[model samples]
Target: MQRTLQPGQRCEVWIAGVTGESELVFTSDELLLEAPNWTLDGSALILNGDGKLWNFDVAGRTLSQVPLAGIPDLNNDHVLAPDGKQIFLSANDGHIYRAPLGGGAAERVTAVDGSFHFLHGVSPDGGELAYVGIDAGDFSQPGRLLTIPAGGGHSTLVDVGAGHCDGPEYSPDGKWLYLNTESFTSLPGHAQLARLRVDGTGFERLLDSETVDWFPHLSPDGDLASYIRFPHGTEGHPADLLVDVVLVSTGDWAAPLHTWPLFGGQGTLNVNSWSPDSARFAFVAYPLANTDSSKDHVRD
Candidate 1:
């Protein structure tokens, strides 16, 4: 069944039942915000706006603020360990940091000084971390996906192809890692999803589309994937980020089962969490009203 809203301005949550279409579970003015990132356990939702991490309980509908000490001048492109023990987030200086889920302090995990780097995703087993690194001088060359121990150790180069790669998420069973890779020479701003073998052999392209695809979050069953699509048409002006859920079969993305359209042209739509049954998902929307390079949270 499909869901169609009446085009209201409030942020709401919806879930699909065993039969019939999805129904509204809850709507809140205090909970949802710009760039909300959800925890992997699906019990709490995390929203990062105004430079802080806020946690909201889905079951209780309560809110708690997490102190992101030692993590200053950075954004919340982060992932929680499957056991809900640690969080791996990126810094504006191009490094990855690991912090306890209880929210006290963070420790630096990767160091690529004079270069820009960011963590794409963390392995569900909490054993390995996948990230992208590039030279500060050149931003066009394909970035490197480095797999290192979650507790901080030597890094292993996973892929070095000539395409920009970012936003990696691992399967629930810890067998496959999915990411977005793009090239500028042959394909300007095209984005596609590629699957990496965790056993250290290599990766294969799962879905290739001209639209800029990013943030592929896999469901608990590992049969479905949700992502954000920034189509190529809205260049220069703010790009309209489209949230989509796709069904996968035999390692191939079959079709986009559902999609949520964006209202503001230059804002980003965040896919932070997914329900345990894979019937519902949560995200934060920010509409960029204008262009300002200094502020990272501003949508326009």
Candidate 2:
């Protein structure tokens, strides 16, 4: 479901460290923003808000809209290209697009296939993209993982057990795709963190938990990871709910390095936000109108 913009809500964009330190960089009691992707040069973050994309300069602490001609409203599922000059965006129209990072006209990357593509990762070499395909735009059908050429080509279906999956992201080394899937259990909406070999073999869960985990994003160095944890029994990653932005070692996901309790759920950590050096990552929080979450707490 498309979550409408909450004009009365306060949108906060924060930068947090692996050591449990965090800083509020930009904020407004206005429209919504989601899925901030750090630039390769570490100068800024790109996020989608109010059905458009904006660039938040990290150093200047300012926000600016990214001008793209002829592109529809975008979803939170977007990934930066390995070249660092382009980005792949998933639009509300259920198609993926390629556009220059600075701002330019976008070119459609997906054919008129029967499925809607929600992009998550671009190969390290920038040759392919990984996304969850909802066949015929049917929400009741399980999402199938598919990889297509970055420039648009035939899609290859990846089997990840017969359950709905989201956030299929590629590792920096390009060997594995890390994501959340429900195949590990029969329970509905129970997404657990897992990884699959690029050849679609060796699928394994990173850790077992009752928490509904989604979107496992590894740092560029392959040492640290960040993901969103929804409350138990939550049907999906919905908006305006209490959740955790968790940081853990890629080697041991069972042990969390930091647990950030905040008021945002779905849009908070849906994409990779790690800085170029892996020292920091960005996330957004959408506090509900009735909640007093301004004094949110962080745990070590």
Whole-model lDDT, candidate 1?
A: 0.59
lDDT of 2 by residue, 1-300 (tens): 445557568888989998998888988786688999999999999999877889998999989999998789888988899889999999999999999999999999999987899999999999999999999999989998999999998999999999889999999999999999999998889999999999999999998998999999999999999999998887767888889999999999999999889999878999999999999999998876776545665777
What does each candidate score in C-alpha RMSD?
7.7, 1.3
Overlapping backbone residue pairs in candidate 2 total: 0
How high a TM-score does candidate 1 get?
0.75
Best by TM-score: 2
Residue-wise C-alpha lDDT for candidate 1, range 213-246, written one tens digit per residue = 6667777777666666666642221333333323
Model 2, stretches more than 4 Å misplaced?
Answer: 1-7, 289-296
Compare the candidates by lDDT and give the number of the best one: 2
The TM-scores of all predictions, comma-separated, are 0.75, 0.97
